[model samples]
Target: MSRHIQDRIGRRLSTVFPCPDAVEDTSRLGQVLLRLAQALAPAPAGNPVPDSFRTDLLAAVPQLRRYALAQCRNAAEADDLVQTTLMRAWENRSRFEPGTRLIAWLFTILRNAFLNQRKRLRREVEDVDGAFAATLSLEPEQERRVELIQLQAALNTLTAEHRETLLLVMVDGLLYEEAARVLGCRTGTVKSRVSRARERLALALGTD
Candidate 1:
């Protein structure tokens, strides 16, 4: 990567992984970083995936993982979703417009893959009883852990539209116009959904 492109990727990564306690944070951001390093390992010779594509994908990983985790609420499954998204993006990379927001395009792909997966598994029973949560080892900071749990639970209560909109606009830092493009809606609609999602989240967290 050129120095300018490297700097740009660094900027995006900082935005996505801004937490000083990211390694110790209970939100699984650390896992995303680890997987990112693994994911960017050099593609084998004869592999058609372009280097620029790989660079852009690397920059998008943090946002993609964060969005996936919010959608699925399972770290492992969310990682799988991101992997699937990357594969699809690589396969169809020729269709992507140059100079556009690559993260937004990847988000659209990830969201579609997740929705398809949900449809396929609609009849199956998920971990509805917090079994996975029970297995996670919490840190020594009880208050912060409890707060994160509370926030995650609040996020879970949001409708799918609200949650998707909130994460795309609020968490992922997409412009309303870009978010609307990802969500297949008008800009005004994106703004409305984000407003309602914020209201709902605040109400759920008792911050309103």
Candidate 2:
């Protein structure tokens, strides 16, 4: 097997067979191999499936729900989106590569599912004055409002690429490298886009 596959198998093994603490004579490598065999062994008769397989999905549900709610105007729709995302992830669990960041993978799945749903519902008219719009709050100060309005307008004017990068970095608190990974771009591209976006925002706010 390739080294990458071996490494992945090794990691999965470690999670399954942690070394005993009291044994002084057991070599670390031996413990690792033992763990690997145990993890790869056929399931015992009547034994339930491992819970670790669902660890990523369980951990990500709250975050996924929050993200969905933010993207969808309706709470009911957001719940449906989360449920769909979970179901899709569960069905595709076997395709997930070991040792990858499962949460990131789940997020990607949720994002794609949401975008697809959005495309399907594109013909629906949005409410301009309902709870969705009212959920948006303005800044307390008049100056802050003006600044925020200017920033919001500038954001609306930006290309989707620029806006997404900026929002992912600033609003979502993703590091530039992580943001680039999500965007499927190079780190340098993320940096450049972020820098340009800041400059554009500053100019739009008349602070440049």
Candidate 3:
């Protein structure tokens, strides 16, 4: 891997898989890592995956889950999208060009997979009216739940293009050029979309 790629993967690894000695418990991260490991287990006998490729792919799972959750708005669906992205990425590992942004390539696959799945799964119900929220047990963190609901509702109001661009740049930490590659658009377009997305999101949250 190139120096830049190594740096990027190292940063992602620190977030997705923190030093075990520093953190007492990482059951959540462990679960995600285990799922991704299983996803990559069936590589062809003769064509084994390289250590660097596996490491980079594993490190990207957290960002993938965030983007998937923003798009799907349901934890189960987001998990499925992430698993599908991992599976597809592993299967097409040979097509990936080295010395390039692996996360960008994975984002492209993830976005395409999400779009294809959306077509078949349009009937899935959403909590647009907050009816589902009413059913949640009133816990100490109910205020936090309400805030998240408001944020998700604000996110849902943006155009698909705006939402995707904002998530790629702001949430996933993709540079403008890398996000442009994933979105198949000009860097200027990505910038404009993110700017507008922030404005629209703020307006939706009644902060504009």
Candidate 4:
């Protein structure tokens, strides 16, 4: 195995199987280590989570909460959604594909969780799409600034599906494929939504 693979396996093993130092038998310790190494090894075709997975999760929570809050109406709901997302991600960590965009994956989880919660509680009163546009519709003294704000607000007026597609593509800088994965849609769908969203925003802001 390459050094990279070995390091990854070592990290996973440490997380899953902490060695016991109380055992004075050298042979037993060796056996335990061997068992752990075997268990931590990657499958034939699948990439296991890297050592940095936990570190990445820790680093991403703040940004993830911010994104969730932007999508949600209230701080309490956003915080709950973020907490649930993190718990779910940690629980299903093994299923996360390696070398993928972790932030996108987390965002997808948060979005799904939010939708599910809304369905359960029937509390979909505040429309983020409308709120997003309203926030951006401010008139500033600077002509250049006002125009930019208007454009941003126009983007917010798009449907949830469209706004998400555009933000994931334009603001989040995700490629079509990655955005599709995050949105749980096909690449073609993502492309169409992004195109339609841009056109609508342009029309809404009288830039068409």
Give the top-scoring candidate (lDDT).
3
The per-model lDDT (C-alpha) reads 0.66, 0.57, 0.67, 0.62
Give all TM-scores, in the order shown. Answer: 0.62, 0.54, 0.63, 0.64
Per-residue lDDT of candidate 1, residues 1-208 (tens digit): 2445333333432332232222332445456546655655776776555666678886777678767765676777877787788778866888988778889899999988988898898843232234324534455688645644554565556566776776677667789999998888999999888777666545543453
Indicate the residue-level lDDT of 181 in model 1.
87
Which residues of candidate 2, in runs, are more than 4 Å off?
Answer: 1-79, 93-102, 115-134, 206-208
A best-first ranking of the candidates according to their lDDT comes to: 3, 1, 4, 2
The 10-residue segment with the lowest total lDDT in model 4: 12-21
Tens digit of lDDT per residue, candidate 2, span 1-208? 2445333323322222222223122544235334533543555776433456544455555556555554565666766776677667766767777766666666667677877887887854242223322343554788765655555566556676776666556554467877777777899998888778767766665653
Tens-place lDDT digits, model 3, residues 1-77: 24453333334322322221211124444465576677567568786777778889978877787677656766667
Output the lDDT of residue 29, model 3: 40
TM-score of 1: 0.62
RMSD after CA superposition, every candidate: 9.3, 16.0, 8.9, 15.5
What shift in Å separates residue 191 of candidate 1 from its native position after superposition?
0.4
